[model samples]
Target chain A: MQIQIERIEHIVHENESVKTFFIRGVNDPRPGNYLMVWIPGSGQIPLSISSFKNDLCGFTVKRVGDTTAAMHNLRVGDLIGITGPLGTSFSIRGERILLVSGGIGIAPLLYLAIEARQMGKKVYAICGFERAEDIIFEDVLNGLLDELVITLGERTPLDVIHKLYEKRRFDHIYSCGPEPMMKRVFDFARSSQLGAEFSVERIIKCGMGICGACALPNGMRVCKEGPVFDLEDMEGVWG
Target chain B: MVDLSADIGIPLKNPLILTSGILGSSAHLLKRVASSGAGALITKSITEDPRVGHENPTVIEVSEGLILNAMGLPNPGVDIFLNELETLEAVNLPIIPSVAGYSEDEFGRVASRLEDAGFRIIELNISCPHSTALSSKKVIAQDIDKTRRVVNAVRSVTSLKLIVKLSPNVTDIVEFADVAIKAGADALSLINTIEALEVDPYVEAPVLGNVFGGQSGPSIRCIAQRKLTDIALAMWKGEIERVPLIGVGGVRTPKDVFRFLLLGADAVGIGSSILYEDLAIFEDVIEGLEQIMTDKGYDMLDEFRGKVISQILDMTI
Candidate 1:
């Protein structure tokens, strides 16, 4: 796919090192779908679509490396090249859904929460952060989600899930975070017989599948077969 | 009844080769391609040491069916790749490892290791366009002396079949092809991606991380065909040894494969087109080739292989 140059419509500083840039030009991106955000000479990195409305789409980026640090400097109206709404998106299932997010993984889940709320499904979120300052989308999730739980200071989202499972039952689980956290969530979901989906991250190149840079151990290209995969599809991936 | 089996030093069930650097990163991925019906598998270019390669945006699509990439030869080094190769032994297909190095000694050492591991075919990558080079020549294939020395170094260490991959960035690829063959290359695969650049006018900077990368896909097909035809004609005129040739660059369809074979390639490599069609392209191309063969009243590739070259020779005579 050719890169489409989009203008940054607005920018939101979500935290000290994280910002969400809402760009104009993406159309109909689903919750888990991601964009290969290009900063020209600095290079490109895959960013999940954190929010999509009308013709505008938002990407939540953390200042991790060169490309992302450059992205943090982009101002409103700056033109950046994008190639996506690429990869699989989360499949909305059941009347109630639980969102488990760790660190910046809250980006795509926040979008999923908004989408699920609009569909009249009860959306509950368990967001984990290294510190309270690192938390993002707090105000938005509190207002939009049916329930929001923030875990801080060594309390992982997995710990919250284990506790929350005792009080209430969820029909499905959606998670995006560090692999170890997601793997724990996957294990929990399987044991509870809850259907689950996850948005995974990898070193993506040629976001269109041909370059095997983002391929999982099972030979599934994360850029193509999924950035979001069903629990069964992820078998042998972590192993 | 159309038989597509081919022999490029090693025998293959068909002519579709999974070109190096596409999806050759791991054993499972190679096995996945094997299940997709590729005739042979060429691993990603492995070096003596692990290379992290360039930063993100190493590859980009300039246009449809066209890609610009400068992956910088990122690999886990030969030691790690050799373990992956052991897992690939269960694949039951010819797995040709593409070896690259910064020096002649590195090339020989890497190839010698693979030979010791019992691999029968080795594809020497002297054509990577964007890799860092210790030699003055940015790409070894650009310098005939460097290419010959690299090939000879590996040849001296291994009795395995050596396929020297040539670079299209060179002025006369046939000269390099001749030198490689004379230096003991058993076959040739051409052309590696051509050097190119993409500048984003909006950002006022080059698009790729490396600033410059190699171009592949349909855009380079005609250029690759011209280069292949030049070497084919040279072979026809007895200017170079008659060795197997694997034509690569923008081969997406059965007709593209037919054109390459008619130009005297023993087989064809599929690379960038995988971005468009994915793994199914292999099965799709194979079935299409069979249909085309059936329509042409030929049951085997040899009946039509180099047919165009023969006709050209007839016209000239």
Candidate 2:
């Protein structure tokens, strides 16, 4: 695989912790396909293709492991080998859609929302976080979202989702976030009979299909089968 | 009447063997072992090609689990592995050769060599984390047709008992296992690695050359167990007696081994831990099983298979 040094054009701290890396994909991977952004000597890790308009792609990361730790140390012009848009993608386009995000989960949804906006879809968003500052993508997300709600941690676990549903319904619900939050969102969708699509925030290893890391509650691999799923199937995940 | 002792399938008292990849990446390496002792040994995934695998930083340890990989399917390959076997004594312990190949023709060719040259059984690797031009290990295990195609192709050409390795890195493991069995698999290995990855906060990149890879170690065992238990349930529910399922993934202790057997595994493949310990772990595991088997008043290993899991989880009529 070809590796490149993506100069960190800028670092956007969406929350106090999670940061979004806007890297230039050497091979120009599409949104949904992640990159194994290589660090000089530390190691490589998989990051979702948060946004892919040009050769540039976005990766939202919460400080996690060694390589990521090393990454947290790097600045502009430090190069890394990028290896993937690996696995599959739900590069779907539509005019009518509901988009949802929690925490750093908005990265991929931001890119997806960009597509919906580009397509002139009346986009709806439910972006949740712990506090006001923890919310990333507020500015970019605001313009892309037709109907948006930022669910901060003030209320109970799922009170935000209840408020969103209390308002209006849409053709689809696109989502990503913590397991419990996603579980509740999907659970609500299932119980209420909302036609929505959700993606699990899987802790992946080989963006490839081999490792069992991103396993569903039922023991299925989430990498290959999904990052994006509907209520019909999300019902069986993360129990 | 069935000549149970005559069969003596595994001399290791417990029905479970740290089937391949548990220990013994090399004869000298699996020199000693400890922890949740099991019975027997199945070596790591060795292929006919000497692969370099992917770059380092291959493995990443995480919160209850880990994601690692060298892209390193990079084994010594068959020729050298076969050569290495010569200096090695017949591991008075049971040894089933775990072989991986890119195609059926290759799998058959390798199995034929192992059968003629050595090894009593052959475990076929149909799944592994691989690198794509763009990413690493992005593909899920196998589609229905590829699963059946590879299993059937290898089975048709081999006379020795064949064990097809199933991918836990899949949507429906039971469904895939069923296909392999129907295609003539003698035994099945449940759940390979889970596909996983990690990323950096500052650099905004992945940690490995291959973006994502299979996750192994203690954390995955529960998922493995759930899948294994389900596979067992399906086998029992469907009465698939002819095809035996060997449970693997996340087995660290004798109790875990016992649990796997109870959950319905003719044998269990021990991985990860053996990496943390020594090779002779086979002896330790076997010793433990001997005590448990005797305590249970079970005369044979078969008696324990699925007994524990069935009693606990089989809430059916």
Candidate 3:
């Protein structure tokens, strides 16, 4: 796949350190599919598709490092190179779904909520962040999801999932976030015997699976086999 | 039944080698490739010290089956890598650790450690085209003296089989192959990705972060074949000592493997094609090779190994 230079049509300042960029060019990317976004001088990094509507596609980025910091500086009409809609997307299953997200991991899950709701699946989400400022897509998730729970600081998405488990049940759970938090979610799903999928992040060098920089312990290339892996694939990986 | 085994210093069940630097970073990944039906596995080039490598945009697909990468040999360094190697004892296949360094002493030190760690075969990567971090901006394989010195440095420290991977960017690959062999290389794998650059028309800047990266994949197959044929022909005509050759670059099919074996390669390395086909490419190519062998009525690789070279020799004579 070649890099397609697309001009940023819009930018959403999600928070102090996170922003969502809307660009034209990504075609029909399912939720959980990522794009290798290239910032001219800084380099390329994979970003999850936060939103895609008609011709415009959005990438929500957290300014953690050089590439993302570069992405933060980009504005409307600035051209950035992109190659993706890559990796396996989340397979919407069951009548109801719970999305567990931490920090910037909420990006793809937000997209997932929009798509799942359209298909008549009841979407519930537990979005966790280090601080209130770190939280994003709150209003959007509230409008789209059947129920949205925001967790801050000591209270994690797992804590909410544990609390919510007593009151209601979800047919499926999807998580994206820091590895440890996702591991907790995966464990919850495994123990609960609920079907679940988690989107993971790695040092994705080539974004095409050949580089192997993003390989999980299971020998699956996060770029190709998945950024989103089902519970079975997550065995031993998180365990 | 058709056999696909070959002995390139080490006996292999097949001739498909998981080329160095694709997915050799960790022991788990290596173990994964080990089960993927590869005859042998070469680790990512391990340097003396950990290298962060180039900034992102380190690799880009120029087109389908063509990739440009300048990873700058980012490795966890030999010490940490040895820890990973310790777990590979159960992997079952020949695991060759590829080593790289800035100088002869560094090469010797790294090779000696791997030797002490019980690795029997080492692929000296003196051909990384985009390794500008080396003291000399130019790659070692591009210089005959540097190539010989590095090979000799490793050879002096360890009695293990040294497979010197040479650069295709050089004018005469046979000369370097000769020097490396004379300097004590037991086997040879070629050619490393050709040095090339891709500029984004819209961005008007280099595509790769390193500005220039090594080009690999199906597009460079003809170039790699020609380079491999040169050294193979040289060995045929007694210009260089006969060492097992690992033909690499753009090998994605049974036909590619057949051509490499016919031209005089004991094994063929699959690197960039993994980007397109994943680990299954190994089985796909091997199964196709078996099919081709069955159709051709050949029971073993030796039946047609270097057949093209022999044909060329016949015509020349």
Better of 2 and 3 by TM-score: 3
Residue-level lDDT tens digits of model 3 in A1-239? 88899999999898899888999889889999999999987889888999899888988988888778888998798999999899999999978889999988999998899999999998888989999888788888888988899999998988879777676588899999999999999899989999999999888888887777887878788888899999999896876
Chain A TM per prediction: 0.98, 0.84, 0.98
Greater DockQ among 2 and 3 belongs to 3
lDDT of 1 by residue, B1-317 (tens): 88999989889999999999999988878889989989998989999999888866788888887799888898999999888767764886798999999899999999989989988998999999889722223689999899989999898888999999999987788899999999999999999999888888776777787877899998899999989988988899898888999999999998999899989899999998998888999999999999999998989889988888878877775
Model 2 C-alpha lDDT per residue in residues B286-308, reported as the tens digit of each score: 66666776777866656767785
Error of 1 at B59 (Å): 1.3
State model 2's lDDT.
0.64
Candidate number with the higher lDDT (1 or 2): 1
Which candidate number would show the highest DockQ if scored against the true structure? 3
User: Model 1, which residues run further than 4 Å from truth?
Assistant: B133-138
Q: Give the range where candidate 2 chain B is weakest over 10 consecutive residues by summed lDDT.
A: B1-10
Per-prediction TM-score to the true structure, in the order listed? 0.97, 0.53, 0.97
Which portions of model 2 show Cα errors greater than 4 Å? Answer: A1-239, B1-13, B30-38, B64-67, B131-141, B239-241, B275-300, B312-314
